[model samples]
Target: MDRRVYGAEPSERDPGPKPGRAYVELVGGPLDGMLLDVTGWPPQEVVDGAVLMSEHGAFGPGGRSGYEPAEAVAGAGGVGRFVWRGDVP
Candidate 1:
């Protein structure tokens, strides 16, 4: 087996302009999947924050917005925005 080394430093790449809302969806689901509604911030920030926050129980019971990490992750799988209108409900 080959071992890979990962860096612990931040990149110098620009994130570009921020957006108004951050929409995400699950890539795959078993049968019925819940959709995640993340607004009030940029997409990148929302995605990054969601991943980090979930790890630290930010989405646990009685969280900041009453969201569970497992539920959120399960709904949106990984995390990404929608492409067309009327996609979110």
Candidate 2:
């Protein structure tokens, strides 16, 4: 096995518009492919936040305005004008 030295990615060192935080879109059930931009600092905060929101009915009935929670499915990759809290361009 060849061991690769880890430091910074090649593109990162180039300083050409460094990428922002690593965020994952919430796909599948009750998410409806919403881009829930989360901070990577706390690690599992993304999933935890999702579950929390779900529990708090954020992804349930009346959680999202206009959009119905019943439409949310897993891995759908569905796109819309406005997701949860962010506006899509």
Q: In lDDT terms, which candidate is top?
A: 2
TM-score of each: 0.24, 0.30
Q: CA lDDT of each candidate?
A: 0.30, 0.33
Query: Which pairs of residues clash in candidate 2, taking residues 3 or more apart in a chain or in different chains?
Result: 28-73, 28-74, 28-75, 29-73
Which has the greatest TM-score? 2
RMSD of each: 16.4, 14.3
lDDT at 61, model 1: 33
Per-residue C-alpha lDDT of model 2 across residues 1-89, encoded as one tens digit per residue: 22111122435534222245333444344444444433332533332333323422334543432222233322222321222432111
Q: Model 1, 9-72: lDDT tens per residue? A: 1252422222442335322221012234454455344434332112113245322222223323
